[model samples]
Target: MEEKILTGRLYDVQGFSVQDGPGVRTTAFLKGCPLHCPWCHSPESQAFYKQLSWMSMRCLGVDACKQRCIKACPKNAIELGVTQKDVKTGTDLQLIHVKRDLCDNCGKCADACYVEALYLCGKDYTVDELVNRLLQDKKFYDRSGGGVTISGGEALSQLDFVIAVLKRLKNEGIHTALDTTGYAEWEKIAMTMPYVDLYLYDLKHLNSEKHQAVVGVPNEVILDNALKLAENGKKLQIRIPVIPMFNHDEKNIRDTAQFCKRLGNAVEVVQLLPYHNLGVMKYLRLSDDPVAEATLPNDAYIEKLKRIFEEYGLPVTVH
Candidate 1:
């Protein structure tokens, strides 16, 4: 049997996202990741398979449902429950329970439910499908010098698919940026480098041991790729997500600054992305453990870190 080409699961194609890259960008979030970073913001993007996510806020109580899901479920995954009682009338509001094992991927429950309590996370798309969607925002890309950014669990994990998409975009004269962890093989990085305009390199940690401890992989490969890109004179922007207990200290900051400085003048900027609980709900949806109970860093500490990078004389942005 022939090997199949693994395309990518596109979670969302967000238009006019300014924070992801310079100007206004259309970001295509690819699915699957090798690194299991504790503080990952898009936890849904990690898994390669199609998974279910429920937004509790969007759920309507059982009063409106017709029990279609209970009948549709093959594994008896869907169960009815009395959610609450009316204060005066003493009537019960029912809800549905979904057993993971019983789910047959039929999607009948999601289709039948009137309220959007259930949602599927990932789906496959071809290169043409992705390019056509991105081209819809060409006017904005032209106006703001913004284009498409390929972000993921890690974009490089799907090397051939990403390259195809990027090459297609370049052929159509669209500016392209890649938000990567730089954990890919050097050859794969080099292959995509020609088509990519800017590189958003993530600097997770300077210490190899600590990097492995948090992200479940060694930092050697990532660091090597970063240096190779820098050596090739690629326009690189180093992004460091300042986690409270991880790389928020002065030592790591200084070391990263030095590394960026060693990249010569090609690297013109460093972005300090402060950690947040934005993805906490995702952990519950995936039934996984949360990374840390630590709080977000205060403004004073963030400002202090900014000054530390400013000592390197490179432009720094704190978010």
Candidate 2:
């Protein structure tokens, strides 16, 4: 049988990135996630379709478009000018109506607009295409011990595509890392492990009920994957997003530390990514809800969390 080719959705291919993994690296942001974590930072990555993001601030009004989008839309979804509607509270709500169902993915509207107010979010690329783009940063990779990091809504959602890309990178002598939620099938994780040199594992919550409540999924599978990876001696860096009113309590921190301790020497480090509103604008662009509305933890809260991890003798970094 002939081998099947795999393709994946990518939102961005960032180069010369240092924070994602070791050294200067190329990061591939894959699309289509399974979990709906209420505090998700990248809400635009959730859907498995080509999304049109409208930045009202970037829009140059009706004069720029020549009404191209209004004509192109089949469902009459695109209407020029401000659309006003009454809210449930009996107040008028003004919104730009872009008939989503009428969009044909032609991107004519985006092309017509000069200021780039309307843009598509997802693009499909073959492994070779992505590899070529990644190799452009080879010089940086060589200097920083960085190669490529595949992150996503969830990298495992596109397992086959990721496997092909990772294998190709490994063949080219590039060190690879996977930033995952560890929510996929074990066999899939095992298949990709040989090619992946590092795993940036996300541990959202310790309690099963709380995990489900916050992330829309139980923690059992994720925990199991971590344990399995540790037992197999995979290089792992566990990360937790410090969201207020969620998993920021001392008990949760201590519990996470204990879990890491059980994973033994396989787990190298823990990173606390303080919640930020950097991605809030993306929510508005995609017309999605803002998940990280809570205020970011103060320096003292962060320091206390770091101390909790230090008690386990585990190396921790706050970012």
Candidate 3:
């Protein structure tokens, strides 16, 4: 009897990623997240299904391309000269446009875009295919104390596929890291615990209401799951994004440090990811309008936050 192949949706597989986990790692960016964080640098990772994206710089305009996307779209989604502000430079220019309401993400227009001005955000990867891509850097992982880090939009969203991928990595003797928001049901997350070597758990905000206002979910379940993971003797590297005006105040930072303190020895490191506008340009690919850029955290501010974490006697690192 032939075994059926399992496939999962992926946003991207980033190679030689030192920031995702310890060592030189190949980070598998699984698609889909429960959180709708406004500060999200990767807008494309939010949806469960694939989404059409437009790269204005790559576009040759309606005249050059002969309205290929406009003509190919079954729903008449593409149009000439709707509006454009150069994504790289803020100046305006005429570029091909995608009609948001009419587009069903059918991807026929993307197929017609030879220049890749129109493209899809997510792709299907079989377990074998993804595993092969991860294994390409096995030598680097072995030598650098690095391994495969399964990061998401929230890896737990695709629980079954993640479990299968993690299990296979563990079988191959690769150090497996699960980077997650701790936003799924406990049972679904529990399935991956056995295979995960380390957890890169994300902590957004401490207050449930404040958390919900920004991220579309409460913090109670996420915090509870973290506690559960620690209780079960799982190693965790707590990742907190130091977003300005959102959760970077003294009280929140202190309270977060306090939470990490309570998590105790299960926590390996408290990594503070300072918020930046580095991903603001990506929003251009996913939206009709430009995203309002947030105030970026300075080095001094990030250092101050790190010192606060250290006040709780928690091991802290800034990246």
- lDDT: which is higher, 1 or 3? 3
Local lDDT at 270 for model 2: 94
- Which lDDT tens digits does candidate 2 get at residues 116-231? 77888899999999999998888888887888999998989998899989989999899999999999889999999899999999998899999888778898999999999999
| Candidate 3 lDDT (Cα, 0 to 1) | 0.89
Cα deviation at 92, candidate 2, in Å, is: 20
- What ordering of candidates by lDDT runs from best to worst? 3, 2, 1
The top-ranked prediction according to lDDT is 3
What ranking of all candidate models by TM-score puts the best one first?
3, 1, 2
lDDT tens digits, residue span 71-97, model 1 = 766678777753866555676666666
Off by over 4 Å in 3: 1-4, 82-94
TM-score of each: 0.92, 0.91, 0.93
Q: In model 2, which regions exceed 4 Å deviation?
A: 1-5, 83-96, 99-108, 288-292
Estimate every model's Cα lDDT from 0 to 1: 0.83, 0.84, 0.89
